[model samples]
Target: MINDDLTHTPSTDQTTPAVATPDDRRPLGSTGLLASPVTVGTSGLGTPASADGSPAAGSTAFATAALRGPNLLVDTSNAYSDGRSETAIGDAIRQGGLPEGRGVVTKADQDPSTAVFDRDRVLRSFEESLERLGVERIPVFHLHDPYSVSFEDASAPGGAIEGMLALKEQGLVDAIGIAAGAISVMLPYVRTGVFDVLLTHNRFTLVDRSATGLLEEARSRGMGVFNAAPFGGGLLAGRRGRDGKPATYAYQAGSPELLAWVDRADELATRHGIPLAAAALAFSTRSELVDSTVVGMNRPERLEQVEALRTTLIPDDFWSDLEALGTPPSTITD
Candidate 1:
């Protein structure tokens, strides 16, 4: 279940990659890539503003800030908002060029309408993503959401796996990996020992830890792990969402019990003079299993806020107190 409150201890193994720091880049497994402790996620930037087909307001501005900010990586997918997310990143690059040594990681997705995940479609998807992003090559590419096809089919000779590997063989993408929501599905891909990176979101945050086993497994195989949504979709980050209807987790309504846990955690954090989000974010960044933590910064104004929170120093006693409260029960399993 996603609501697992399993605690983690940092790895003792010397070969484990360096933990990402606020001011420096950390290695992404052995892919010869490096990224900041925090990576800007762009799923929200591609939201359709209206029936008129205009991009959301402030999307480009936010992208520009992220591109020029301290972050060394920006993560997106071809399936996000039917490819508008890449367009927004591209526009941001054109408006204010990507900073030196920073990288953009994208994924190859199946055809939306037909659900075709073959080599031909993968090739087409990569080309289209490059065109939309106005880039000739990508640093890391993934086979996203392979549930459309069984593991057997995806690993077939002419399947999407071949397509992603071909991209790496051709030097079009520096690294290749799997990005998916289901832990069961992702575990299989990670066990194959072919992927260089692994991206899992909404499962490694403070209130939930369904991705615990997955992260450990991936790291043991020498794969970089990106843990997204350290805020648990904003509940663990704050008491109430912008809607003021209580915070939500995993895209569903936060249960009263879950809200109560947040309330208790909030008081605990306040008593220690720290915002709750700091603890939430630190949970991911401090984990030995995680190489990078991906957070959503969809607006220009949020860049500074996230940066501040990313660097906040919470007392160790506060973590002890927060842990004493225990995690909320799973009401919305991923």
Candidate 2:
């Protein structure tokens, strides 16, 4: 069942700080859409339960807070909670009006169960997203998780990418993008120059820089890059005092090496007297290649913490010490 709180109109009291205005907004590649450096990721806002059937609370207040900001970008997908994320955003927009010039980025992908990747599915998925978002046109529509199915199937003639481009030509989507977990699968499309934006998550962060090459390639092709999960999933985002919960990397159990890497990062945070999450968030956004860093939030308090982390300045020596710990094999140039 969908959470009733997410279905109802949100109160105005739930608003957060407004997004940056036009003059202050940062360019999002060649799309001409100006957005804040930090995008609000809504994946956690609509998932009803964990794989263990543990209750996961979804909040309209979080959506309201995200939309209250000016020039902010809200990232969602039809796959998230079977489209509940988009519904929550629509309800929030109706209850709490969206800030001027705010951008909404949603995605269409094949059904995990069916593995269907075709033009009809893509168009139908996008139509559902538009209805759920309560918008006639979307600023950015992404082809989500192409690697789950055959990338060739999704990109071939009469495929998902072709459908998305058709929508773009019709002015339904200002720009099309690709968001996926597999860098190998995404690189081919990135090199093809079909997408205006690219989003890679859990691959580029304080503990990992696996996507550095992909980020560079996308930037070289004039594509906007949005880096997600800067905290190495929930590992780097947890409070300092608590024993780290079982770490999950890229939505899977963290390997021993990954866990060890996070432990070292925790130790470094303790020494510097900085929140681990603050450093993680800053590291991802500090890179010139990243046009925006998306962070998922489930509560208004989490949003407040993110805002603080964005403005908090870390010393140069902190970065130097961080780099000394160990850099990923791939070189990350500014």
Candidate No. with top lDDT: 1
Q: How much lDDT does each candidate structure score?
A: 0.78, 0.73
Q: How would you encode candidate 2's per-residue C-alpha lDDT over 142-184 as one tens digit per residue?
A: 9888755676777789988899899999999998998986778
Off by over 4 Å in 2: 1-24, 49-58, 239-245, 328-334
TM-score of 2: 0.86
lDDT (10s digit) by residue, model 1, range 208-247: 8888999889988999988887877767776365566656
Q: What is the TM-score of each candidate against the true structure?
A: 0.89, 0.86
What lDDT does candidate 2 reach at residue 173?
91
List ranges where model 1 is wrong by over 4 Å: 1-22, 50-54, 239-246, 332-334
Q: Candidate 2: give its CA RMSD in angstroms.
A: 5.3
Error of 1 at 286 (Å): 1.3
Looking at model 1, which ten-residue stretch has the lowest summed lDDT? 1-10
Clashing pairs in 2: 18-69, 18-70, 19-69, 19-70
